[model samples]
Target: KEFLQWYIKEQGEEEENSEANVKNIKEAGDDLSAVDEKMGTRGG
Candidate 1:
């Protein structure tokens, strides 16, 4: 029973971390897209 409790806690932490990572990736992607657009305009 103790092990199960610990496992559940670990899973919850992992899920939170995963969500944070996803949010960071999305923000990074938006920044990259903006940079790409500027580069495209300059190239043309």
Candidate 2:
């Protein structure tokens, strides 16, 4: 039971970290898109 609880906690943390990374990636992509739009390129 103790191991299972620890495993569950670890899994939850991994999921949270994954979500944060994805959000950061999305923000970076948006920044790149904005730059492209400003440059009047295909990203517009």
Candidate 3:
């Protein structure tokens, strides 16, 4: 029973970390796109 409780808590923490990672990745992609746009304008 104690093992099960610990396992559940660990799973919850893992899920939260996974969600945060996904959010960071999306934000990074957006920033990259903005930079790309600026570079494109400069090139032309």
User: What is the number of backbone collisions in each predicted candidate, taken in the order shown?
Assistant: 0, 0, 0
Model 3: lDDT of residue 35: 96
**Quick one: best lDDT, which candidate?**
1
User: Which runs of model 1 end up more than 4 angstroms from their true locations?
Assistant: 1-13
Q: Candidate 3 on 1-44: residue-level lDDT in tens? A: 99967765776589987677668778999999999999999997
Per-model TM values vs. the true structure? 0.67, 0.57, 0.66
Model 2 deviation from native, Cα RMSD in Å: 9.7
Q: What pairs collide in candidate 3?
A: none
Worst 10-residue lDDT window for candidate 3 reads 4-13
**Highest TM-score among the candidates is held by which one?**
1
lDDT scores of the candidates, listed in order: 0.84, 0.79, 0.83
Give the worst 10-residue stretch by lDDT in candidate 1. Answer: 4-13
Ranking by TM-score: 1, 3, 2
